[model samples]
Target chain A: MRVAFCFDLDGTLTEEEILPQIAKHVDLYEEIELLTKITMRGLITFSKSFKLRVRLLSTIPIPTVKQTVNTILVNRPLQEFVRNNKSDCFIVTGNLDVWVDEFISREYGCAYFSSRAKVEGDKLIDIEKILDKQEAIHTLRNSYDLIVAVGDGMNDCSMLEQADIGIAFGGVHEPVSTLINIADYVCYDGLALAVLLKSLKQKYGREN
Target chain B: MAGKIDTVIICAAGLGSRLGLDMPKCLVEIGGHPLIYYLLNVLYDVPNIRMVVGFKEDIVMDCVRKIRKDVVFVRNPAYTTTTNSYSLYLGSHDLQVPFLNIDGDMYISRDNYEKFVDKIVPGEDLIGVTLSYTEDAVNVLLDSENRAIGFSREKISNYEWTGIAYLANIKIRKEGLYIYQELEAYLPIQTEEISCFEIDTPQDLEYLSNKMGHL
Candidate 1:
């Protein structure tokens, strides 16, 4: 059976939230953290909060954002798992593609879907496009027999709801209640998440 | 088919209302740590571990992740209306291999529990028997060979069922009988006596806490 393993970028893969780490670069950590918390709490819509967060963070040059994201640590076991199973892994994140592109490419070398950023030679201008996570799952539906999606944010609700198996991961932070209500499994650690994914992959044809 | 055991199924789904703690019994604190903490430590060497959680499952998972993160958790949403036997059934349904079943609310000595685990031989069923101590227990009736012949609640016996067993997946029946009662059809199974304490009431907790303090 063909299976696709989809993961959220910020808190699910990275040990810390990426945007907030980038916010630290421009002394706007508090603002970005507040936005992230409300977004995760479902107090604000993901699109609205994400757009505003990007506007606030766009002040930092593109190079600075990439550098900050590069310094952020990822969950080691998860990274290694994705690196080993590159053919079956996909990263689905709402973060700007311009910011995380280089870091994700170098670290994981896996296919990714991210919100787009309109840039003019090293300077951010406007949000070109916002990624709807469900679209990534829908796109992979034809090729895979099962889509297992993992995330820890309020924005992940749609993608998780659409996937064959939704995992509410809380390794770095608590998964929002809305996501938890729909998750097939709620995992709280990185190694545990990787192990679950491996098991699912192994048991796909036999007893899934 | 004797071989090394690969998996352990820990039943931690009960409300444990008898203790009146308003929390999952496994989360009950004994020596500054939850009871499940000690059990996880005892099974540290086992390769694959699964926990069945229901009452306050979020809290239990959070607590366990801090200690051991690799345990595969299975949710038993019917915990309120069911017993540990049902929890064991849910945990073992997908398992095609032999596994160790253990109660969540116990404080077992590491050395003694390890010895019991060492005696495990896959494809062969074994029941764990501990010294009789609790006010209420399912006593194990042993033959001259020290093998378990039957289980009784009212009969006086020197050893009580420890709620720990090593058996293949075929022994698990879907009936909601208590774990020991479920094993009645498979009686005359091998028995392993280990040093352990099960917390069922306030008295049991206090007694074991003091006993562990002196140990």
Candidate 2:
């Protein structure tokens, strides 16, 4: 089956976001807010904000994040979706390298595009945009016969609108109405997306 | 109320150190995914499940968390220092009504679970539901009244244990609560007029899985 499955990292596959996980360790709430405003005003790319956030949170302790993320990630249903369709899947997120590299990206063996983090001395630093998500989705729209994009949040709206099948995920944060309006389906559960894609592949997978 | 059984405490605290997995036994693979996933899926079908975790507790919780985020997780802080009954007692309070107890690593079939619970008379004080036992099972003896007499030894009894199910009444619920206050408390309680079923080791797990396949 020539299928492409793309997803939002934090809420789609995980119950919580990486930033909140970092926040649990580092008292970077004030600095994180500053980065959010900077990104909102287009002052810096998402990559920069991610880098700054991780760099600030680096002192919090790597083992804590590693152990916590491993605990948070291990048997997630969202990852099951990706695993069930490993060959055709990809992860598109604004999350950092430490999580994707350590937790999911390799385990599922799927291509993932996300903001890159700066790390030194076992400490994670700023994020630099490694893959512009919108651009990636827009490019993929023409590359595949059918595209399924699953994500939660306003930022995911652009990619969802560009895909043949758009699934608004509520596993993380709820998507904005505008984003939902553009999606073909909105499901509160991540497994529903997996089921939908599985059926889609079964029905049309063998068609020439 | 979140329904009759608002919560369920699955005793997954066993350190299956024999399996030699980096993660816990619950997180080991039976069907490409973790073994705990199978139990959790059938449990979620019940609509109310609170997982009881201890050994590699974080791993077990993390594994279950991805599948159902709203599930209640209670840790048996003294898991390594206790037994299955003790683990259940540690997190028993969250289950207010007659609760269904399950082993975290066993393979479960939804139809069997439904069939067993359906036999329970709605408001009756059914202490426990004991099924016939098979060889390689921890067997229970049934009296004339069908109350569990004691565990069998000389021969495999007429009934074999179906480790896969339970329908505990409130009295047993209270007993379960008090059973672990002292370590030896479990011994006499084990000899009480209690209903018994078996779910302790991998031999039973393989027997049930081979019998039931994946469900």
Candidate 3:
């Protein structure tokens, strides 16, 4: 049986949120951070919050955003685990592909389903489509027998709930209570998370 | 089996009326720490742990959250009228992998506990037994193969039940039955010698307190 590992990009794969890092460059860090917190707590809807946060960040130069994305630290152990198991790993994020594509997709060369952004010749424009994480999981479920999802925010609730094994990661931020409630396992350290993923792979990976 | 023992269903929903404690038995302090603290510390290698809480669940959950934020809790609302079997049933009802079923009232030396964990082989069901005698101990009758054929409140055999077991994936038929009674249906249970004790009365608590300095 095939098994897939789904990861959330922002809080699960990176130490910082991509949008907040971009917000710092445009001097809207505090405001965007508040919005991010509210959205993560499920106080506000994810689609509305994503549009608002993207609108706040759209004015920044594309090069500046790319440079900041490069500077944002990836969770090294998780990156290594995904790299070793790239065939069955997928990044499911609500972040725009135009912003994170270079660092996350191109750097790792891993498959991802992310929000699409309409870019008009090097100028940041508008969101073309917001990726529904649950839908992505459903699509992967057709091929894989078991899906293990890891995330920390409220936007990840649906994907986590849909997965066979849901792990609420608190490596970047303390996972919201809603996500934790649905998670089968909760991990606080990146190394521990990596170990858990490896153990799960041994247990459910197709080769096993 | 799909995996090694990755989950532990700790039945902490019982009300320890004999111990004269206002809190649940799992929350009773041995030496400034809850009884679960030692068990969880030793079980760090196991990835999934579900705690079934009922009487004073909030308090027990609070203590557990402080020690290990990863623990998942399943509340048994009928803790007042139910036995540990019901709480065990609630915890392991939906699990698909092998798990260790333990009572929250149990306290053992770290060395012996690690030995018990080491003895657990994948896909094999095991029950922990000890030669130590207690009037309330659940006695077991084992065949020559060391498979338990009978369990009784009276001294029916030389070994006493230790309230710990490693179970394979099997659905438990919960009909107000004790965990042992349900387990008896699946006879030929493998037995292991492990040093463990349960804190059910004031005397057990006092005995644990005396051993606390060594633990």
Candidate 4:
């Protein structure tokens, strides 16, 4: 049976959140950061907080947003591992595809499922729809025997709960309590996470 | 990023008095092979292997050398006066990276060994445990977080601490004390439950010998 390895983008894959970086360009970093914290802590709905943050940064130029995202560092070891096992890996995020597609999809060459954005010719506009992470895992379940989800925030709880194995990552931010409560394993470093993924693949990858 | 654990310290300095053997405990034959044979075979992937030998060190070294020639031997000359704690301290007193610490007397299945290795998460210290317990087993008590809160010989909890642990660092202020006592100070220590058996008595040897007969 084939296994699907799903990763949360914002704080799990990238060292920092991209929205806050974009907010830096528009002088709204503090406000967006506060909202991000609230959303990550499960104090507010991610869908609501995400829409508000995007609206606050809607006036920023597309080029500046691109440059801001380009400066964000990818978790190098995790990226390398995902690159090596691209056949079964995915990036599942609530971030807009327009903002993250260039780097995550184009450069890293990994498949992704993210919130759709409504853009008007080089200028930011609004979020068209938010991707339900749990639904994403359910869709992948049709083809994969085991789905392992890795994330570190409240928004990732559903995805983690729905997967065969859930790993709460603390490499960037300490995993939120809600996510930790549901995770089968909590990993604090990339090597440990990589080792776990490899072991799972080795154990269940050949069973079916 | 974390690195793979490459070093393993095996404490094999005990005398097999309970088994009524005159040789080192690690050299006792279990199913036509020494106890170290099964241990070394299970740990072959680790790059660095260190063993603490005493109580007929020459014979133990000669026997172990036939299995794996690359092992570095650390001698505990005061094997009569010291316990396994001293042997463990002598084996891993100066190391920076995390390494696995395993007792030499354990007889574990290959599946259980692989499961134990898979349960290891880098950056978190772990103590391998089993749900099955005996009256003489050193049982462990865990909090909600699965951290070892207490350890005792009595049936204090449902989990028994197998003599297997992964230490994140080798720097210790109390070298003479038992490893679990030294580690208890660093609370919230993680635990992993795996199938394992320790060959400590004549009955244990008989039980394992009979168990292996079915295979």
Candidate 4 regions with alpha-carbon error over 4 angstroms: B1-135, B138-162, B165-215
Q: Which residue segments of model 3 deviate by more than 4 Å?
A: A206-208, B1-24, B41-102, B114-127, B131-137, B142-154, B165-192, B200-215
The DockQ scores of all candidates, in the order shown, are: 0.23, 0.02, 0.10, 0.01
Candidate 2: lDDT over CA atoms?
0.58
lDDT of 3 by residue, B1-215 (tens): 22356788888888899999898888878799889898888777677777888888667866887898667766676889988888887777555677888888888776776677777777878888988558877899989988888999988998998889888844566674787888887887888888888988999899988988785
- Candidate number achieving the greatest TM-score relative to the actual structure: 1
Indicate whether candidate 1 or candidate 4 has the larger DockQ.
1
The digit string of per-residue lDDT tens for model 4 on B36-109 reads 89989988778667787778876776687678765766667677887888888766654556788888888777
Better of 1 and 4 by TM-score: 1
**TM-scores of all predicted structures:** 0.81, 0.44, 0.76, 0.55
Ranking by lDDT: 1, 3, 4, 2
Q: Estimate every model's Cα lDDT from 0 to 1.
A: 0.85, 0.58, 0.83, 0.80
State which docking tier applies to candidate 1. incorrect
Off by over 4 Å in 1: A59-64, A119-125, B1-7, B31-33, B44-49, B62-73, B89-98, B122-125, B131-160, B167-189, B206-210
Instruction: Report the error of model 4 at residue B127, Å.
Output: 15
Model 1 chain A: lowest-lDDT 10 consecutive positions: A199-208
Write the candidate numbers in order of decreasing TM-score.
Answer: 1, 3, 4, 2
After superposing all C-alphas onto the true structure, candidate 3 shows an RMSD in angstroms of 5.1
Please state the Cα-based DockQ of model 1 relative to the true two-chain complex: 0.23
Q: Note each model's CA RMSD in angstroms.
A: 4.0, 18.8, 5.1, 18.8
